[model samples]
Target: MIEDLQKYYGYLFEEALLKEIADVAIAKDIKANDIIIDIGSYITSIPLLLSGAIKILREDKEGDDLVLYYIEKGDTCAMTLSCCMGETKSKIKAVAETDVRLLMIPKQKMSEWLSKYKSWQEFILHSYHNRLQEFIDAVDTIAFLNMDQRLLKYLKDKALVNHNDIITVTHQQIANDLHTSRVVISRLLKALEKRHKIELHRNQIKLLEL
Candidate 1:
């Protein structure tokens, strides 16, 4: 696993640093829909995604959750970094969007590596920047776009991240992610279908265009 990780861009640290990571990091394989990090849970390690995708979500007080962004192969979870850096509990949830494999670096090493390794610092900073931009984009979508537009954007994002135009998800699931009612989502989705933007099936949505 160490040798395999060495070939990745962000994991190309110095030999000593690499050795340290190999010694302390634990590799985990998770299946789709598995909850990796739950709100209010104290995090002990930061995960480095090696394959598949993870969806980061923030839940409202009423228990409705909205997907903040996705972390795919070669990406790290910035929400996890915040928890580890502050020694606090997680404010967001991370769920496996597909079968995933990742390496978890202990929280202590996360802090140590920030100062000891240049590569790790750069990687973390880049992740933060990307996540922040995604948040900004999401905000813009909510503020400036209508429900139909938002649904289209959401479907496009899911398709892009999953590397397929076909998405296997339910209308209720889409409503949950977008923080809307299932009835509203169903109506908007039908509008999208009428416009030839997507084709809907039983628990599936196939994008016809962006």
Candidate 2:
């Protein structure tokens, strides 16, 4: 666990802080598609990603989820930090995009370490900045891009995060992430297939010229 912590976070934290984290943080392994955080749940810890990817989502009024972005290894979720600091229930959902390894630090340590460690404070602030930019990108994708373009970006992102060109996912799952109907997703996916951007299989989509 210490080696994993140092591997992912050494550059961002001091040796003493890293040691403390290894001692106190609970190391966890989450399988793909598992819920890391759920809407309306009280967040109790902050996760420092060790490996794999997690997708952050926002729920719409009709209870559909819209993918915001994916966080890979060596990243911490800003939404989790916010929930910890504000002492509020989570408004976002974090789902494991791949089998994941992470360290969960007690939420109370967030404030304590913020004042105690310079690196911790800087890391938190930087995480927030990065997350805000991702949110802006998500908004831009929804507002400026066409549905097909959005779907293309989504597929590329999934491939990138999963570290595989061949993504194992269904059209209906894509629809759920994009907040659209499965029929619409299936139609657009076939169009992409015709354009030679992707190859559709039984339940998977292989990225091509994308």
Question: For each candidate, C-alpha RMSD in Å?
Answer: 1.5, 0.9
Clashes of each: 0, 0
Clash count, predicted structure 1 = 0
Could you tell me every candidate's TM-score relative to the true structure? Answer: 0.95, 0.97
Candidate 1: tens digits of C-alpha lDDT, residues 57-147: 9999998999888889878988899998898989999999889999998888887888989988888899999999998998899899998
Worst 10 residues of 1 by lDDT: 4-13
| Global Cα lDDT for candidate 2 | 0.94
lDDT of 2 at 73: 95
Give the per-residue Cα lDDT of candidate 1 at 131: 91
Among all windows of 10 consecutive residues in model 2, the one with the lowest summed lDDT is 1-10
